[model samples]
Target: MEGFLEGIWHPLIDNEKCTNCGFCYNYCPKGVFEKNNQNIIVKNPADCVDGCHGCEWKCPGNAISFPKPITKEYVIKVIRWSKAKGRNVSKDFIKYALKNQIIQQDEVSKEMRD
Candidate 1:
């Protein structure tokens, strides 16, 4: 997938709790997790998209923990990445994020300029 967040955010698997059922391996759309021999491991954490938690809930053993904080920088990064890919999501959403104080205005300005 394009613009996958990779290192910015990735799932943390608990080895002690993991049942090795491969749920994350099967469910990850971007191939973030892979089946290694009889076990499963995250092969490309950076390939995981921002704010995506599909693997967290899919793990029956509850071994996944993605503790990525969604800061203003992350918001801006996603916006810029999407725009660079020609996905014109509504500007109103950006305005709303600013008006609601979801992101700092300076951060948005810098992102737009970039």
Candidate 2:
């Protein structure tokens, strides 16, 4: 699950529209953005909390954007792929999907329900 999500859903900063106001750097609780001299970079993209859009909403320049939006279908696809690959999809990930409203409780597999 971590491997699949590592670079999948992180924010992308468009430099053209970015004013380097540091809103993303300051607002992100995951330390995803870091100040590099006068510029901001996504330093720890993998550390970003899944389904969070706080930084995007807080950015005054509207420079922050995610590659993909979290949705029930997307979550289900990931779970199915992980299972196909014989990966142990963690219950915490399922719980996170449910808590974030990305997927409903019934969408989780019967084996995953426990």
Which is the leading candidate under lDDT?
A: 2
lDDT of each: 0.75, 0.77
Worst 10 residues of 2 by lDDT: 105-114
lDDT of 2 at 30: 81
Give candidate 2 misplaced runs (Cα > 4 Å): 1-7, 69-114
Cα TM-score per model: 0.55, 0.57
List the candidate 1 regions with Cα displacement exceeding 4 Å. Answer: 1-6, 69-114
Clashes of each: 3, 0
Measured on C-alpha atoms, candidate 1 has an lDDT of: 0.75
The RMSD (Cα, Å) of candidate 1 is: 6.4
Query: Model 2, 42-114: lDDT tens per residue?
Result: 9998888765567876788888888987677777776777678787766666766788787777768653543
Q: List the residue pairs that clash in candidate 1.
A: 6-46, 6-47, 7-46
For candidate 1, write residues 11-111 as lDDT tens digits: 99999999998888988889988888998988887778765667876689989987675557667767777778877644765765677688987877777
